[model samples]
Target: MNATQFKQALTHVNLLDIRTPREWDDFNLGGFHVSLDTLLERIDEISKEKNWVIICYNGTQSLIAMRLLKAKGFTHIDHLEGGLEAYLSL
Candidate 1:
């Protein structure tokens, strides 16, 4: 979703930050950190009961990650429309 929609619904969804460790250490907007590279291996760590919002540097990676999660049977997966860059700008 776009930043406005994301912010409006943030409180109700599960957030997954899929940025690299270095990127995560640079700054975080809360939620769990699981780099996209290792996401598949750690898929079980995520909860299926809640909607998930994936996050990344520029939204490109997170969009890919969202597709992966959907293919893995996650029904409610979405990525930040423009990732942190856009979100921060908002």
Candidate 2:
């Protein structure tokens, strides 16, 4: 989803941030954080029931995370098209 769509759906979807720990600490939109590097290692911890919206510094990593989650049988998944950078820009 794009930033606008994400904002519209914010209250309904689960936010899954997949950035580095440092990046998350520096600034974040507030969500369940799981760095991209450790995503696979901690995949099992994420719930499949919720509608998840994956986010990263840019759209790149979140796209990867969405794929990983889909592979793990997560049916409801979306990602910010341009990430927080784009959202903040708005």
Candidate 3:
């Protein structure tokens, strides 16, 4: 979804920040960080029952992550369009 739509859905979604540690320390948007590189290995750390919104620096990584999750049988996954950059712009 777009930034505005993501923001509106924030309260009802579980955010997964898939940015590197350095990027996360630079600017955090209140979600748990699992870095894209380690996401697959750490997938169990996230709850499968909740709606998850994957987030990345510019949204590309998040989209990739979303697809990965889907392939792994996750049905309630989405990516924040434009990522944190778009959210900060608002």
The C-alpha TM-scores of every prediction are 0.95, 0.95, 0.94
lDDT of 2 by residue, 1-90 (tens): 999998888888889999999999999878799999899999888899888999997799999999988988999899999999988888
Tens-place lDDT digits, model 3, residues 4-76: 9998998888889999999989988786789999989998998788899999989999999999999988998
| lDDT to native, each model | 0.92, 0.91, 0.91
Cand. 3 Cα-lDDT: 0.91
Clashing pairs in 1: none
Report each candidate's C-alpha RMSD, comma-separated, in the order given.
0.8, 0.8, 0.9
A best-first ranking of the candidates according to their lDDT comes to 1, 2, 3
**Candidate 3 regions off by >4 Å?**
none
Residue pair clashes in candidate 3: none
Tens-digit per-residue lDDT, 1-71, candidate 1: 99988888889888899999999999998898999999999999998777899999899999999999899
The regions of model 1 sitting more than 4 angstroms off are none
lDDT at position 59, candidate 2: 93
